[model samples]
Target: EEPWTLFTDGSSCVDGSGAGLILINPDGVEFTYALRLQFAASNNEAEYEALIVGLRIATQMGVKNIQANVDSKLVANQVLGTYVSKEDNMIKYVEIANGLVSGFKTFSISQVPRSKNKKADALSKIASTSFAHLSKQVLVEVLETKSITGKEVTAARKIRLKARQYEVMEGVLYKRSFLTPWLRCVGPLQAEYVMKEIHEGSCSMHAGPRSLSGRAGESQVPDRRNGLLHEMDRSKSGGNDYRRTSEEICMGQYCMPLWYSKRNNLGQRTMVKSSHGDTPFSLTYGTEAVIPAEIGMPTYRTTAVDVVNNDKELRLNLDLLEERRELAAINEARSKSKMTKYYNSRVRGVAFQPGNFVHRSNDANHAAAGGKLGPKWEGPYEVTDALGNGACKLRSMDETILSRTWNVANLKRCYL
Candidate 1:
């Protein structure tokens, strides 16, 4: 039987601390867990907690001969006896982990690269950002205590803010400055307005965040569609003035003859080597359209009046119309084949199988201040369904399926 595999990762951000575990059974079925820590912990502490919890889960499932993968080299080395846990907290965590490890008949811990452990990493980030609820196939748990003191209860303390120079007025803070009477502290909404004005306002210099004083730069680039529209408006200014004049009537009449002459020239060119060597007018009525020159100066065929034989020839041409149309269809297909071959030769072909991870272009989903340094791709979405001809449906790391399928040209494989 194949050995069970466990992948674990941890995340500690300002939002919260979280642990993620993915257990794959011998049958290849998976069970995912997103654990949120209610208590305070460092990133290393979170990683250790994730490993301990995952071991406990595997023990409960009666798993034997298991192999565990973790992205944290510190945790993996400590657990494997390669590194010593010197800190008090780490020592306690290591003991708890070893105690859990003793439950399995055979077990091994190995450190893997972050790229290979992305699913677990994503889950840990999600747990840190949001409260993930447990479902039938998935489990989410809250740990109130650190692994070192599993049963210890911690007391909460309330701290008072010391802002002597700032006063709260109607839920808004105002700072007292020597130069000014009082300066209103800007909230996120006000800050956003200020940034927008600085970046894109008519009077303001169109500068990036890196150029702005004390402002952090965004990862997305600015769109150039507005600049294109402004250029188009400038080009149409002279034409706009001419549109409101009596000269427009004269121009319209002058353009009609030119248009008609162009159309007649195109029709004559098309008839020169048509599928059946016959002009469209001749094919329709079994007689060519008479030109003005032919009417002014009579031609031999135009003057001829052989009505009896003409009727018989007209019947024969009418009967051959279907054959001529079929031949035209064949020629059109051959032309399209050549075009398709040429197009394929110039463009590289990319095919993605279902379950592959890929990053999509971020052109349609840029943030307001996402200057030139902004991320060019948005996701490492999984290919859930491959709709042939270079189209595929994608699902995000969070399990949210995108509404539209993306073309392969707009997608690139993600290594991590």
Candidate 2:
């Protein structure tokens, strides 16, 4: 007989609030179970409790093989050893879940997004409030069919839908952890949300009403009354934690390099030590453009440098100073790639002349204030004057503020 899948979920009001568990068996048995855990507990604790109780019921039913689907990515990942659970209450649940896994001859846990887990999610919500005890387990044969002819029947490996960002393929979870967060839709998720490649590193889904900072980039700040009015309205509506939009910025120099010149499709570049006549490898830059696939990305100077050095083996520089030098080498390779990649484009090589409008690097404050520089390359600054070399003077559009002359590598063309 093939293994059956049990989908379970839990819900609770507070740390010590009401809790319940719901499980469904694919073979047509539907079970609604509830238990109020003593003492205040977290959502994770309730989730763990639900699973334990459901597992106990399955074991009693003589089920020998099972796949457990859950909506808690953190718990799922923790069980799979991909992430560590740091909470004290969660640790206990983790240990219990592990023990149950060891005891079951065939058992696996998988993560699913909440959208794909509607039934279990609904059951959990129902369990949270109702105290009705369905004394007997409900069983209904969902499907049964066979050909009368002496024909052979085969069943393929089952693939269960886990969540919006995950799926169970042959009982293994393929978790895609990227989510597009909406600006106005801010709050803690009852269940984990998976982030995807498109959204990548950005945190906010939609533009926030408030102009959170002084940058004055693009916004309707005055009309939105900034974040202050939004916060007050949210508070009056019973939400006290509403605040500014979530921001994510990447920074670092040799410690974390940047990548550019991806606008043109030359190919990707990498910097690394080279042992002559070996498979070439490329190191990733920290500031990389999240471009669509099939676009020509630039290649690094590592391949060229390795050929020149006749170095047969690649080794990462460990000493801080040595690493800094190695990083500089990689940065140079990246810069050359970017410049060469964009040399002939309609956009042309980045050039700044006097009176050009430009936005400072996103991390201007951080880098200038020693707060950790975000994307090192900055500008759109107008060229005040051509400086003979690969440099030009710049100025802000609004303030007419003059900026120090910058190298071509430091400028990026303005884009809306």
Which candidate leads the pack in lDDT?
1
* Predicted structure 2: lDDT: 0.49
lDDT at 398 for candidate 1?
Answer: 95
Q: RMSD to the native, candidate 2?
A: 32.2
Going through the candidates in the order shown, the clash numbers are: 5, 34
- Residue-level error in angstroms, candidate 1, position 376: 59
Candidate 2: worst-modelled 10 consecutive residues by lDDT: 249-258
lDDT for each candidate structure: 0.67, 0.49
**Best candidate according to TM-score:** 1
Tell me the spans in candidate 1 whose CA falls farther than 4 Å from its real position.
132-416
lDDT of 2 by residue, 1-416 (tens): 56667776777764333434455566666766656555566677767777777788777877778788888887788888888879787777788778777767788889988887777766666555543543335355755655443333222212233245444443333343222111111111200011111112133222243322111112112122222111122223334333334231111111001121122333554223332211122223322233331122111322124554333333332224345556667767877777776775545446555555545554433334433543654544566677866676666655464646666565566654
